[model samples]
Target chain A: MRGNRIRGHGLAGYIVLSVFAVPTLFPIYVMLNMAGKDLFQYTLRPLLPTFPYHFENYLYAWQFLARSFFNNLVIIGVSTTIVLLLASMTAYALARHSFPGKRFVFYAILCVLAIPATVIMVPQFMLVVQLGVVNTLFAVMLPYAAHQSLVIIVLYTSFSQLNESMFEAARIDGAGHLRIFTTIVIPLSKPILAAMAIFEVWWLWNDYAWPSLVLSSARLRTVALQLVTFVDGMAIPQPGQEMAANVIAALPIVLLFLFSMKTFISGITSGAVKL
Target chain B: MMDKPQVLAGHRSARRMRDVRIYLLMLPSLVLISLFFYYPAVSGFIYSFTRVTTRGAVWAGLANYQRLLADTRLIASFGNLAQIVVFNVIVVATMPLMAAVLMFRMRNPRAQYAFRLMYVFPMVVPMVVMIIIWRWIYSLDGGLNILLSLVGLESITRAWLGDRQLVLYAIMFVNFPWMGGLNFLIYLSGLQSISEELFDAAIVDGVGPVSRFFLIELPLIRDQIRLLVLLTVIFWLQRFELPLILTDGGPGWASMVPGLRMYHSISRDFNIGYGSAIGTVLFILVFGMTMLQMRLGRRRAAADNR
Candidate 1:
C-alpha cells in the first residue's frame, strides 16, 4: 500500500514540480542565453537563444569587472580568514576552558547576534569616518571581520561537544594551549569550520548595502557593488554585457555550489537557523 | 568566619588568574566586536537624539524624533513595509511549504536529489543578478511587456516599476514562485525528520494526501513554520535593497521603507541624526519581535520536553 502511494504520487509530483521549475529556473536561463547575444541580436530575439554566439560579451565584462573581482577576492579572503581564525580560537577558549566569567563572556558574544547590521549601520558609518578608513577596502573588511558572532556561536557549540579526553591527553603530553589547539581541536573542528567559512564567504559576497556605503571609490568596488554600478552608471547600458557581468559576479558562488553543493546549502541553512 | 570566607574568595581569584591565558585567547574577538558592534549600537542610540553636523554633534533632545513623527515619507515607507511584510509572510508560509512537501514525498532518491539541485542551484547566483534581471523584466520593452504583447494582452501592460500603485507589488514579485533557498531547505529538513514508521502507519490507515498533510506533516512541522514566519517578518521589516536598487523608493515614495529612508539620510544628505532615529526605531521593532519569538520558542521546547 505504501509503495502504491509512492508510485501514485510520483507522476503527479514530477509534473507539478516541473511546472514550478520553469519559473524557478527562468531567470538563470535568461541570463546565460542573453549573455551570449550582442545588442542587435538581443533586440532581434530577446527571449530565445541567438546564433553566432558573442563570447566577446564575456570578454568585455571581464575587462570591466576584473578589478572588482580582485577587490572582492582580497576583501572576502582576508575577512573570512580573520573571522575563522579569531572565532575558532575564541570558541576554543570558551569550550575547552572553565574560565572565570565564562557565562558573561558567552552571553556577550551571543547578544551581538541579536543586533542587526542595519540597526547599527548609521553610527557605524560615523565610526568608520572617525577612524578615517572610508573609501578603502579596510572599511569593508574591518566590519566584516568584526561581525564574527555567528561563526563564534556555531563553533562554540561544536567545540563544546568534542571529546574532552582528547584535550586532557594532549595536556598530559605537556601540550600548551596553542599546541593543543593546533593539533587536536583544529583537526576535529575542520568540517564545522569549513561550513562556517563557506557561509561567511557567501554572505560577504552577497553583501551590498554595507560595501556600497563604505567603498565609494570605483577602484574599491566589490563585485556586488560593481554589478549595480554597471547597470546604472553606464552611459548606454548593453544588455548582453550587463548580463555577462552578472554571470561574472555570480561565478565564484556558482563554482562554490558546484564543488560543495551539500555543504553550501547546509551552511546557509544552519547559519540562518541560528539567527 | 570572615577570615575563612576571605580565604575562599582569594582561592577563587587565584583560579581565575590561572585561566587568564584563556581570556587572552578571547581578547581579540571581544575588542573587535565591542569596537564594531556594541560601541556603534550604543552610539547610534545616542546620535539619534543629537543633531549631527559636519563639525560635531549638538544636543538636540527630541528634535530629530519630532521631525521623524512629522515626516511624510517615513510614514508612507512604513505603510509600504507593512504591505510587503504581509505578502512575504503569506508567501513564506505557502509556496516553500508546498514545494518541500512535494519533494519530500518523492520515492526515487535520485530524482528527489535532482529536483532539489534544480530548485536550489539557481539561488547560488548572487541576488543582485536576479534583481537586475527582474528590473529588466519589468521595464517598458522588457520581458513582461513583450510577453504581454505576444499573448495579445498588451493593453494591460504597464511600466511595472513606474506605476505608483504597482511598484510595491512589483518589488514584492521579484522572485516569483519563491520556492527555493533557506526557507525551502528548512521545511524539507523538517519533513525528513519524521519517522518512516509513522508515515507507513498513516498510509496503512488509508489517509488521503490532503488528510495526511493536515494530520501528520502539518503538526510535526509547526516549529519550522513558526521559525520561517519569524524570519520572514524580521527580514522584510528591515530590508530595502530592492527599493534602493530598482525604483530607488521612487515613482516618488511608492516603494520606500524606513531602512531606505535611513540609507538616504546618511548617503544622500548626511542627515546623521535623522538616520539614527530611523535606525533606532527599526532596531526596537526587530529586537522586540526577536524576543517574542524566543519566548514562544522556549515555551514550545518546554512543552516538547513535557
Candidate 2:
C-alpha cells in the first residue's frame, strides 16, 4: 500500500521536475550552445547552435588556455594534499589523543572557522607582500591550507566517532601514536579523507577572490583569474573565443564531478557546514 | 602495572613520549594557522588603522573609516547587498526545499538519481564560467531579452546589465530555474535521513502529505535548513565573484557588494589600510552573526536535553 501510494505521484513528479529542471538547465545549455557557435551569429540567433559550427573557436582559445589551467591544477593539487595531511593529522590528534588542553586547542581551531576570508584577505595580502611571495603559487597555497579549519572540524567529528576499543587494542599491542595513526586510523578513515580531498579540491579549483588578489602576474594567474582577464580586461577576446575559454575553464571540474558524483555529493552534504 | 619502580618509570616515559609525539604531529597545522590565519587577521585589524604603501605602512587613525563613511559608493553598495541578502536568502532557502520535497516524493530510484545528477552538475562548473555565461546572456543583445521579446514581451526588453536597477535583479535571477546547484542535493540528503516509520505512522493516522510534511519532515529538517541558511548568508556576504565578473559593480554601482568594495579598496583604490578597514567590518559582521548562531545552537541543544 505504501508502495502503491508512492507510485501514484510518479507521473506528476516527472512533469513537475521537467518544469523546474529544463529552465534550471537552460542557461548552461545556452552556454554550451554559445561556445560551439560562430561569434557573429550567436548574437542574432542566441537560442540555437549556429553553423558552420565554430569548433575552431576552441582551437583558437587553446593557446591562451594551457598556462592558467596548469597553474590552477598545480595550486589546487598542492593545497589539497597539504589540507588533507594537516586536517587529517590534526583531527586525529584532536579526536583520539588525551593531551593537555586538547579541548582548548580544538575550540581554538573551531573559532578560526568563524572568521571569513574577506576579513583576513586584506592583511593576508599585506602578509604576502611582507613575505615577498606576492606573485607566487606559495602565497596562494599558504592561505589556502590555513583556511581548512572547517575541514579539520569535519574530520574531527568523523575521527572521534571511531570505536575507542580499536585504539585501545592497538595501544595494548605496543603500537605508538604515529604507527597507529598511520596503520589503523588512516586506513580506517579513507572515506573521510577522500571526502575532505574532494571537498577541498572543488573549492580550491574554482576559488577566485583570494587568488585574484595574490597572483597579479599574468604567468602565475590561475584559470579563474585568466577567465576574468579574458572577459573584463580585453576587448580582443570574442564571444566565441571567450565562451570557448569559459567552457575550457569549467570542463575539468565538471568532468571530475560527473565521474565521482556519489563521493562528491556525499562530501558536500557533510561538509556544507563550511563558511 | 605499578608493581615495581622500573615498570612505573618505563610506563611514564613511554606515555610522555607518546604525548610528545602527538604534539609534534599537531605542529604543522598550528604553524600554518598561526602564520597565515591568525597573524594576518591580527595584522589586518592593525592595518585597518594604518595607511599601507609600497614604502611602508604609516598610521592613519580613523581616516580610512571616516572616508568610508563619506563614500557614496560604499553606502550604496551596502544598500544593494542588503537587498541581495533578502532575495538570496529567500531563493536559496526555499528552492531546494521545494526540489527536495519533489525528490523525496519521486518513487523511482533511477529518476531520483537522474534528477540529483542534473541539479548538482552545475556546482562543478567553475563559478567564473557561470558568471561569464550570464554576462553574455544579460548583454544588451544577449539571449535574455532576445528570448523575452520572442515570447511577445517585447515592451519589457532593455539592456539587462546596463540599467542599474535591473542589474541587481539580473545577477540574482540569472540562474532562474535556481533549483539551486548544491543545496538541492543537501536538502535531498536531509529529507532522506528522516526515518520512514514516522511517515508510515503519519499515514496510518490518516494525515495528508501536506500535513505530514509540515508536522513531521519540515520540523525534522530544520537543522538542514538552518545549516543551508547560515552557509548561504556567510558565503554570499563575502561573495565578490559575481559582482566582479557580471557587472564590475555596474554602470553605477548597483551590484557593488561589500566584498567587491573591499577588493576595490585594496586593488583599485590602492588603499590597503582602507581595504583592511572594510575587511574588518565584514569580519565583525560575520563573527557577530556566527556567535549569535552558536548561542542559538546551545539553546537548541538545551531544549533537546530537557
Candidate 3:
C-alpha cells in the first residue's frame, strides 16, 4: 500500500514537472530548429524546412561574433579568478581573526551590496571615460571586481561557520597563516568556493550593461553585446542565423550548468537560507 | 621582577602583531572597495547634483531635479515602471510558489531532479539569448501562434510582442521562466526544513491541504516570501535587458521602463544630466522599497519566532 502511494505521488510529480518544463525548453528548441533552417525556407514556408541542416550559421556567428565572445570569456575568466582569490583572502581574515573596525567594514560592505549597480552605472561610465579605459577590457574588469565584493562577504559568512578547533590544531602544529589558508582553509571551503565561482562566472558571462557602456570597440564586445549587434546588424531578416548565433552564444553556459547543476543549486540554497 | 614585567610586555606586543597581521590580510580588499566602490558611489551622488559634460561638471544644484520633474518622457517612464513592478511582483511571487508546492509533494527523486533542472535551465541561458529566443517565439508566424491555432484558439494568435496592447504581458511571460529557479529553490528549502510531523499532526486534526498550507507552511516560510517579494521588486525596478532587446522601449514607448529610459536618454540622446536625474529617482525608489521590505521582513520574522 505504501509503495503504491509513493509511485502515485511520483507519477503525479512527473506530470506536473513536465508541464512546467515545456515553457523552459520550448524557446531553446525553437531557436535550435529555426537556426538550422535556411532563411528563404524560413520566411517562405515559415513552418517547414526546405533544406538540410546547415552548420554554416555557427561558422558565420563565429566569424562575426568572435571578438565579443572572446572578450566576454576573457572578462569572465579574469574577473572570476580575481574575485575568488581576493574574496577568499579577505573572507579568511574577517572570518578567523579579529581586527579593528571589522564590524564597521563588514556592515559597509553590506550597504554597498544593497545599492543597485544601475544607480552607479552612469557615474562609473563617466569615471571610466575620465580614466581613459573606456572601450577597453580593463574597463569591464574593474567594475565587475568592485561590484562582486558582496559574494566575498557571502562566502566569508559561510567560512565563519567552520569549526575553529581545526584551525587551532593547524596553528599548534606551527603552520603559518598563509599555509593554513592554502593547505587547510581552501580545500575544506571547496563547496562554497565552487558555488561562488559558478555564480560569478554566470553573472560576468551574461552581463550586458557595463560591457555595452565600456566596450565601444566592435572588437572588444562580449557575447551578450554581440547578440545585440547580431540582431541589429541583420539586413535580410534571417531568424535562423539569429537563432544560430544565440545557440553558439548560449552553448558554453548551458553545458556548464548541466555539468554543475547540483553544486550550483546547493550553493545558492545554502547561501540564501542562511540569510 | 624587571624580567617578568618585560616578558609580559613582549606578550602584549606579540598579540598586537597578530592583530596587525589580520588587518594586513584584509587591506587589499579594503583598498579595492574604497577605490572602485566607495569612490564611485560618492561621485554618483555628487554627479546627480551637477551638469556633467565633456567640458566637466559645474554646480547645477536643483536644475537636474527640476528637469527630471518637467520631462514628460521621464515621468511616463516611471509610470510604466510602476505597472511593470506590480505585474512582475505578482507573477514572480505567485507562480514559483505554486510550482514549488507541487515540487515538494513529489516522491520520486529523479522526477524532482528533472523538474528542478528544467526550471533552472532558463537562468543558465544568458539574458540576451533568452530575449532573442522569446522574440522568435512571439513572432507573427512563430511557435506560439502556431500552437494557438492548432488548439483552435486562432483569435488569440495576434503578434504577441509586436502588438502594443499585449507587449507588456508578453514581456512578463518571458520573465516568468527566468525567475522560477531561484523561487523554487527557496521554496524547496523552506519546505524541507518543515518537519513532517507537523503535517501529520494537521492531517490528524482533519485539516485539508489548503488549510494546512495556510495555517502551517505559509506562516512558517513567511520570511522566504518576504525576501522573494523584496528581491522581485528590486529586479523589476531595475529591469533593462528584456525591454532593451525585445521592444527597444517601443511600439511608441509603451513598454518604456525607467532603466531602459535612463539608458536611452543618455546613450541615444546624450542627455547626461537628465539620465543621471532619472537614475537617482530609480535609486530612491529601490532604496525606499528595500527599506520597507526589510522592516516588514523583520517584523514577520520576530512574530514567527514568537
Best by TM-score: 1
Return whichever of 1 and 2 wins on DockQ: 2
Q: Which candidate model has the greater lDDT, 1 or 3?
A: 1
**lDDT tens digits, residues A183-267, model 2?**
9889998988887788888788778878888787899988888877877777655777778888888888787787887788778
Better of 1 and 3 by DockQ: 1
Best by lDDT: 1
lDDT of 1 by residue, B154-246 (tens): 998988999998998899888888998788989999888887787778778877777888988999999999989998988877777888889
TM-score of 3: 0.90
Better of 1 and 3 by TM-score: 1
Window of ten residues with lowest summed lDDT in model 1 chain B: B1-10
- After superposition, the stretches of candidate 2 with alpha carbons farther than 4 Å from their true spots are A1-11, A233-236, B1-9, B297-306
Task: Put down candidate 3 lDDT per residue, A1-275, tens digits, no spaces.
Answer: 11112113345556766776777677767777778777777866555555788789778877877777677778888888888888888888888876669898787766766577776677777778878898889998987776656777777878899898888777767666799899888999998899888877776777787788777877888888888888787787777778888998888878877788788776656544322
User: Model 3: residues >4 Å from true position, as ranges?
Assistant: A1-17, A44-51, A269-275, B1-14, B148-162, B175-179, B293-306
Q: Ten residues in a row with the worst lDDT in model 3 chain A?
A: A1-10
Task: Sort the predicted structures by DockQ, highest score first.
Answer: 2, 1, 3
Task: Candidate 1: list runs displaced more than 4 Å.
Answer: A1-7, B1-17, B300-306
- How far is each candidate from the true structure, as Cα RMSD in Å? 3.4, 2.6, 3.7
Task: Tell me which residue pairs clash in candidate 1.
Answer: none
